[model samples]
Target: MSVTASQVHGAVQTLTQSSDTLFLLLGAIMVFLMHAGFAFLEVGTVRHKNQVNALVKILADFGISALAYFFIGYWVAYGANFFADAQTLSQGNGYELVKFFFLLTFAAAIPAIVSGGIAERARFYPILVATFFTVGLVYPVFEGMIWNGNFGLQAWFESQFGYGFHDFAGSVVVHGVGGWIALVAVLFLGMRKGRIRAGKHTNFAPSNIPFLALGAWILCVGWFGFNVMSAQTLNGISGLVAMNSLMAMVGGIVAALIAGKNDPGFIHNGPLAGLVAICAGSDLMHPIGSLITGAVAGALFVYLFTYLQNKTKIDDVLGVWPLHGVCGAWGGIAAGIFGQTALGGLGGVSFVVQLLGTLVGIGIAVGGALVVYGIINKVSGLRLSEEDEFNGADLAIHKISATSDD
Candidate 1:
């Protein structure tokens, strides 16, 4: 049978829709795998007694964020149709459904970061409360305004600042927000046992290098979907994003090797740093730019983790700030330099405006997290009882012992 003009047009439309759906699905799968990465990473970093607690937190955050995103979180972030003037969202029903899954993944990052902060000793209920607020309110409200085409903060920045800060994916929206929350939670939860002494620090080797390796690998791989899908258009952009991501990870690995003085633990985290760095402009920058960004991010992780560990006595059970906060900041700034329209319009942001917007994002992220964590601490109390902390949260709180008797 001869193909009519109408048939050709219908075929094209079907192909286009199918392509969009495929990309969305790919993004969802990659994001989900990052949870497994977190599980191994967190469990490996903490003591054996607390391993189960950390792992449980990772699982809980992933599950809770999924449900929360499906319910109120997705609507808050992308459901502007809940309000009028959400024209772009209204045009496609699929966009609405995809938005929920996307935001769920994004919102999960904050709770994941916070998990490291409260690890080893916190009561699970307090963490549950914090997760509820972060997914349901903090992340969705701000990021929704950014991507949903609303004439709110992002638009205001673009109008007044001559260039809005462009995080091609979610360096600022996801990783930055997560890091800030982790920082605040760390403050409220206080130091873990043996972390603070008179004037010196002790080395706490990861319980399992294999676990750390696995988590870092998962995060690095998933990042391709996380960063690339943010562009959300069918074309060569996904390839570029993936390429940038890979190069950045390579650069990070090299940087970590050099900075760590050949330590395996430091080298292991390099991939995560690279992934986080590229997250800001995976679709907007060339491979060379990713190389530079990734190296810097990897170096920053080394410095931040070491300094914070010894100086502040902040026992980041999984080094969340180093991987998420520092690298996430690098990714956002890199977008300003490499996001030229020649690339993907990410570098088109003016330096000054991008700086301002970045600061505003940082402020919102850090300040909101501080306030939220403080309140949670006040209401539910952030850490476990002193005796409980010494005994380990896994057994103390959950009754899941680390010993063979279990």
Candidate 2:
């Protein structure tokens, strides 16, 4: 039988759609596993008494995030609804469905970031409520603005700056938003009971270095999918993004290793800081520019974390604010600088646009968190009672404690 041109086109389209769908499904799965990274990272950083709580909060919050995003957040972000019958929704080889799943993983990351910052003290139910609102309403508003062009902001940027603000993998949209929101929640919760006494900061060592290291490793490995698969289709994929991400990650490790004076926590977290910063410009920069960006992010995380911990009263349990918020913001700005052709980058982003966009995302995050957490504090309360907190969140809240051997 002779194949018509139309038939050939249709077959090619089908294959392309199937490939893209599988690609995104794999990316979603990788990102989903990052939640485990989040859980163990928090578990290791917190006291043993709170280990169970850390794990529980991350998993539960992910559940809440899925419902909120599937039912509400996705529509808000894209103005698309899944109200259609399954047959209709499954069109295009179900690429749209998998797309939602991919984005849902990113949306859920907001709560994962917050869990680390507020671990050991936050009440379980109240934090879950925060996750619902943050994922459903606050995060989607900005996600819509940047990714879907829901607002006129992108249009205005293109009109004036020659390009819209670029965030290849959500440095600002996901990490920045999550980080700043975590900062607000951290401030609201105040210091953990004995974090600061007599104006002296107390050090609470990690309960398990191995677990923390494992979490970092998972995040680092999964981040390839996070950054590269952001292309969303086989046609858009670029090896440069992968190369830049690797360079930035190593850059972060080396910078943190030096800046942190051989601190293992800093070393493990360094790659995360670099990855966060490189997310925005990963598609646009030379590997060298990416390395510098990651290095700057790593050093900035180390210094800001130290300053926030020892010189300030901020009790950010896992330094979420610095790791996500600060590094994310740096990523946004670095994209503008390193994405310029003058700097051996792709040359589309504007520094001013990047700055404005980053600031707006941060503002929205802070504002949304304040409203959600403030109301929860007033109505339902945000933290465990003094006695419950003293007993460790595991036994106090979950009634299951990890014994020393376990």
Compare the candidates by TM-score and give the number of the best one. 2
Model 1 score (lDDT): 0.77
Model 2: ten consecutive residues of lowest lDDT: 397-406
TM-score of each: 0.91, 0.98
lDDT of 1 by residue, 1-406 (tens): 8999999998888787767766776787788788888788888788888988887888887888776666777777766334345565445536555655665777887888778766787889778877887887777766776666544777777788766667778876788778877877887777777765676876577888888788888887787778877766565446887788889999999999999888777898987888887887787788888888899989999988988877776777667877887688778877777666565444557656556656766777777777777888877788888999898888897788655763
Q: Distance (Å) between predicted and true CA of 246, model 2?
A: 0.4
- What lDDT, from 0 to 1, does candidate 2 have? 0.94
Give the alpha-carbon lDDT of every model.
0.77, 0.94
Q: Write the per-residue lDDT of candidate 2 for residues 1-406, one digit (tens) a residue.
A: 9999999999999999999999989999999999999998888889999999999899999999999999999999999999999999999999999999999999999999999999889999989999999999999999999999988989988998888989999999999999999999998999899988787898799999999999999999999999999999989999999999999999999999999999999999999999999999999999999999999999999999999889888989899999999999999999999999999998978999999999999999999999999999899889889999999898888888877554
**How many backbone clashes are present in model 1?**
3
Model 1, residue 340: C-alpha shift (Å): 5.0
